[model samples]
Target: MKRITLPLTDEQISTLKAGDSVLLSGTMITGRDAAHKRLFELIQNGEKLPVDIKDETIYYVGPAPAKPGYAVGPAGPTSSYRMDKYAPALLDMGLKGMVGKGRRSDEVIDAIVRNHAVYFCAIGGAAALIAKSIKKTEPICYEDLGTESVRRYYVEDFPCIVAIDCEGNNIYMSASDISAPI
Candidate 1:
């Protein structure tokens, strides 16, 4: 498996391809549907956002509360489609990567290609296992949203698959083609 460090550069993103297994390390921010809506609204209103997303990877997850000795609980990837509406805008604003489960919209894929970004798929049922990679969690904003609050996570060796690469190649499409009736 390829190991990647966060704040991915253009060279790194360009080298990734759909279906590549990777282990990501370094910092990434977390945001779910609610937080995304807020960010979208801010952008629409021309107001400054609370967080700087430039060159950052946003993971679509609302991690559970931490256990006694842990930084976070069973942190898992959330369905990515829900963020599709806001994704293109975010990508335009310099967001480079996204981590989540499931497929993304066509517009999102186009934006990913246009911006030379990448989308990774985290295993859905491996929340507990995923949580082990996160070394620290710090609240960023939208705290009132509770678990859906935005946060920053410092992680090491976070496992994921390149579901969609910079050039718009998608593993989901390949999978569908393989399963389609001839």
Candidate 2:
């Protein structure tokens, strides 16, 4: 497994390849559809975003409320396609990486390549297991969105697979390219 530091540098991102298993450490922000829409709108209106995304990673998640002695609860990736509409803009804004589950749109994949970004896939249904990696969770913006609110998480050895590398090689596409009939 490759160990990656967060806010990935250009060299680090370039070195990653689709299908690489990675253990990431450092700060990653969480956001799902609601938060993405709000951020997209803000960008559309030429307003400053609540957080600077340059060199930062955004995890597409909406975690359950923490139980006692936990940093977060049931933290898992949401479907990446739902955020595809807004992802390009975020990439354009210097967002370096994204973490989520499932396939992404062609446009979104293209944007990732153009922006020199990487897309990771967190295991679905591994929520409780994943939360153990989180060391800190703090609200950052859009508190009214409740569970969908944006938050910053400090993580240690958070597990992921490189679903789409900076060069635009996509694991999902490889799966789709399989010609054998099941």
Candidate 3:
């Protein structure tokens, strides 16, 4: 139950594993379905993106609007699989981590392993609770994309479980499959 924060580098990320607790800071871009589609198309057509993927963490969250005195609204991890199709390409470009809920494709897992990346899952159904961890947020591009638009967040000890690791380890499956006491 230790805490680790970011601007973490490859060596730091490569060393992480499932079950590790993390508090990520720095720039993590938000992208769900629509944004992912646009990013994929851009990559395919060799178009430039607003931000580089190198050693970046992609959070699978589309937060609600911020209320007064808040930098962002209720923000929490969304389903991970929705972004699966576009994940491999991002990982190939040096995406080192992701934040979301549930499982992902084997291809995505393989991409994580092959590219030395990891996936973290936040507590689902806890948007309000999670929002408190976010110190601030702002849009980067694709503003018309709504909350799915790329943005940056400054978080303070945002909690998460490292569900997948660079070596292909995953925690969610094991957690779900644990036998109940008879």
What tens-digit string does per-residue lDDT give for candidate 2 at 1-182? 99999879999998999999999999999899999999999999999999888889999998888888877889999999999999999999999999999999999999999999999999998999999999998989999999999899999999999999999998885465788887
lDDT of 3 at 159: 86
Q: Rate the local accuracy (lDDT) of all candidates.
A: 0.95, 0.94, 0.83
Query: lDDT by residue for model 3 over 48-133, one digit each (tens)?
Result: 87777787778888999888887788888899998999999988888888889999899999999899888999998899998898
- Could you estimate the TM-score for every candidate? 0.95, 0.96, 0.91
lDDT pick, better of 1 and 2: 1
Arrange candidates, best lDDT first. 1, 2, 3
lDDT of 1 at 78: 97
Cα error, candidate 2, residue 104 (Å): 0.7
Candidate 1's C-alpha lDDT? 0.95
Q: Which regions of candidate 3 fall more than 4 Å away from where they truly are?
A: 174-182
Superposition error at 118 for model 2 (Å): 0.1
